[model samples]
Target: MQKLKIAIITLITLLSAKTSLAQQYMKFSWKDLNIDYSAFAYLIDSENVIVRINSTQSGVLKLAEAAGKLRVHPGYSSKARVLEIGIGEVIYSKDNKMSGSFPAFRLFQENYDPVTNKVSGRSYVAQATKIAQKGYLSSRPDVKVQVYNKLSDVQQNVNAAAYFLKEEAYYKQFAKPSSPATNNNTSTNNNSGNKPAASQAATPVTVHLVLVGDTKDASIGESVKSDLIKMRSLFQNTMSVNKNIKFNIKEISGDQLISTNVENTVKSLTVGSNDAIILYYSGHGSNPKGSNSDFPTAAMIKSSYKLENMGNLVSNRNPRLAIVIGDLCNSVPRTRTALPDQPLMRSAPAQHDPARVAQLLIKAKGKIVSTSSSYDEYSYSLGNNGAFTNSFVDALTSAINSHSNMSATWDAVLKQSYKEAYNKTRDIVNKTGTKGQNGFYRGSVAYN
Candidate 1:
């Protein structure tokens, strides 16, 4: 309370002292400053823009600014609600509404109004946080009503004409002509979580485990694919213990896989109903059109094999599920150069979509594609195995061991795997300050 009062005094002083709109900052408290939630832009420089606003809990996060919508990172914040509007850090009024360096957050509120009433707004905030976290709150029945409520707050805020004006000049710094690539929370594998029920008749399930990588051109497979390969045995062994699942895993590698045979291998697969095909590619990839390009265009490719349509090919067989994950670069820059260590994975192969190439390998509705890094970022490796692939295996294995009905709980496997991979990789990146590889699930985000 003391701090809030002090801030109040400071803001009043600052407001009175400064007559220019270009002031560095205006410190204020939540108590008296009833300014409804508005868009804010922090200009780090002419090129780098940081978009932010306060939420109920996660504070201000680094928002991906584009169009008129702030995308992703809504679940992450620094725990501070202050906007620190200065040094190009801005929020402005335009035409009578909020428009500026940042877009008004897609504040979907239900069950209450936030701007008019503080208590109801708090409830809305709690629900928004829950939605941002998704399935993690499945067990929290108490909050379900608010969380599941429709996206009405945004409309409500607009209808009441309670919206703030947008500062167009500052907003132009971050807004893009094209819509930005959406945040991907897609997870590839969920085969580990569910076990077919005992009462269910024994049905042979066909699963194809395709390991795509380069072992010859500085074989990343030695480090990236080995543990994943070893874990395959554990996966099969665990699956085999069940008399119901008759599974077969075929790993294709060497110079042959690196050649034209890559496409042939995927195109030749045979899958039956209730079948699943898992494609794990540990190599380099790129987003040719740029990171802002749609996900299908960011194909992660290599010299050894044609993996672009792997997911689609598998899905064509009408398998029950398709899992495609790429441990490689999914660059966002217009001009993406391949890492110096890689030869075949060119520097942003033009018109290539690594997600489709690497992740959407099958293009089936039942598929999940997760990648290690977004465009313009590099992936990390410890010894030989990739940080993403290693964490992915550990998460899935743990989920599998804890559950038995794999058929009924594939999504559970995906959730845990996605969470583990993201957290493990995020930890390393945060600690090392590494600039590439923050893995994300392309389907629905399973991580809390």
Candidate 2:
């Protein structure tokens, strides 16, 4: 009897060690949406659960179904089984009224012990809430329990098994390897900083910036002006390093903000193969009814022009890179009231690395088309600056000031900017009861 007891204790220790190892946090990517997910697996009592952190509504739904179909052979608890799959709501409330809710999910487990003729349960819940200031979801621990007595209880719950099973079938059709065992899309940090190769350093490049703003609009005129100034400053600071790199900026505002003038300006510009052209417009914008494209049209005083047209023109020049940005409302026009300036707590200034800036602006090759708001969303302005523009500038600034040993990518900048803009818009809407805005970006830039 003593020897048997020792063996049992040894087996229990081994199982606990295995469970601890399995609980290591993992990262995954949904390549279809270019979204990354992080999760960790662990056991709750005798039940096994996988918790995914900071996921979108689609991601949570998909993951919840995947969790239901997940079968653990020789699981931590030999008699454990998946009991439930559902999303936890992150309710956004104002004045005691629910304004919005972000979707979150968790996997729950139940175990039966034959010796004790008893059942036990536990769950791991993850909330899909924005990280403060960062505006993106991150993995954090949040656990809750909702026990079900039997299989019938799970069926009776609003989060029915049938729903998860149906979703599981739909997701299984296109599901790539998301499990840690098969996940190989891990991101590695490049500590090489922004140092260009000798050949790239010798290449002469010219960055042409065409900034267009509608300074006539009473609502966002000052904001447009501020955006232009900030953008010019960003470019000048970034390009100040290489003597071989020429930085040229063109401003078209006031009466020259017409579509013809804008077209003429882009038409007359001559770009070389080693050059980059950036067109930024800060003004009213809209999506026409039944518009096919996801991009918005720049709403000028008397006319509206498609941003895709400008993007194509810039791309036609065959420059190394082309970026077209429109910071405007994609929905119907509405009167915007500028909020009073709130003093922000400033952090210590980051030391800028010119080589890193050059890597993104000069060495990179490809086009980027982005907008301040998605279709049918309002682009917001705070004080004298558009929220998206502020977020973009901040992202760029952070990239430039990143650790000298770390590499920066335009993709990261764009994603960060989009998330930050979304968070900013959401916060403003929550506070002032304004419409929310979510920025969008597409295209890729390749950097060596």
Candidate 3:
């Protein structure tokens, strides 16, 4: 009996150790997007290790030391075709050769009508430069034509063709890799403060800021242009003043949706573990999932359920300094639901949460997250800019004035922005005193 108990204890210990090692996060980037190289690393509960790719030339798939080898998705391709710029007129004659002053139109897939088998939609026409008075065989139409037209249109067409091809190339490059195995057994930090080793020198850290503005739901007056401008200025000031810190800044506007495109960009930025990444998002918040009566405060997904794509960008242990600041209105009453026009006045607040964003913050290895409002709060704004964004900028500027880090700046900005916005629109919130405190949500978490 004593021997059996000892054996069972040993077995349990091994199983527990294996389970703890299995859960991990893997991060990828643009280079890894095309070829699965050493773009990703694994962060186990205890130790994190770099995922080394063995080959880049021979096989389509390669395995990592931690995450097994993944096959690259087969990229898409299409036949290339020449496009004609302009054509004046086309005339068919009996002879094999035909002539015209204006050049013939070049046919492409878009211009050609498959149903009609003719270039019906195109402006230019195809004309044979060489013409014979007596026409040759009509059955064999395999003939060459010389095209001519305006120089400007030709230049434009060439550019268009190039752009289209480039877009297709970029899309194919973004295909996702095969999911890594989640085995605990297979799954996978250090700090030195004062004294440096004889061979070691502290390398100056480079902080990369990728600011994305999500204003797709912006009304005519609530423009986010000024907020973006202010954000840029803050980044510039930080980089210019701090001799030890270098910054690479990226600004994305509403033109870039918070979808796969945004995800790809984030992946590209956060791949290097040495980087300090600051991601700021300004936009309208919505829950794609329907409202819940029991827990009306549950957060909603703005779009699809396959939001893992967005989550994957920050889910891995990639960056050294990661700060995510979001300026979003979480408590906007659903349009279908009968709620007050003034979000502050809604009697029965629909229970919606920004849990997705919260979960993203937790998944990040080293992170500081600050939200404009609380999970259940209705963030307000006025004069064509969002309330939260304006406050966020104000807070950031204040923090800078105090010579504080990014987190301090956000805290100051958030407080100042809200103060300014509330002063401007006190009447709205004053009327519904009941939901006053309940309508605001702010998240401040520090993980270094």
- Give the TM-score (vs. native) of candidate 1: 0.42
Q: How does model 2 fare in lDDT?
A: 0.55
Per-residue alpha-carbon lDDT of candidate 1 for residues 158-193, written as tens digits (9 for 90 to 100): 211111112122222223333554758544443433
Candidates' C-alpha lDDT: 0.38, 0.55, 0.34
Question: After aligning candidate 2 to the native by TM-score, how far in Å is the CA of 137 from where it should be?
Answer: 51
Best by lDDT: 2
Relative to the unseen true structure, what is the C-alpha lDDT of residue 429 in candidate 1, on a scale of 0 to 100? 39
Cα lDDT, model 3, residue 266: 72
Q: Model 2: per-residue lDDT, tens digit, 1-448? A: 1111000000000123233422111111121133233332222322112222223342222111111122232343345432222222211111223223224332323454434423364323233232232522223332333333333333343222212222222112223323464447654433243444422366678889999998767777766766775576567543454445677788788788888888888878878888989999988887756889888888776887888888987898889999998888776555333565432222223455656667777779999888877777778776546778878877876786645333567787777777877876675552235556777778888975
- Candidate 2 positional error at 35, Å: 53
> What order do candidates take by lDDT, descending?
2, 1, 3
lDDT per residue for candidate 3 within 13-92, as digits (tens), equals 01132133322222222221133212222222111111222222232211111111111111210221122221121111
Quote the lDDT for 44 in model 3: 20
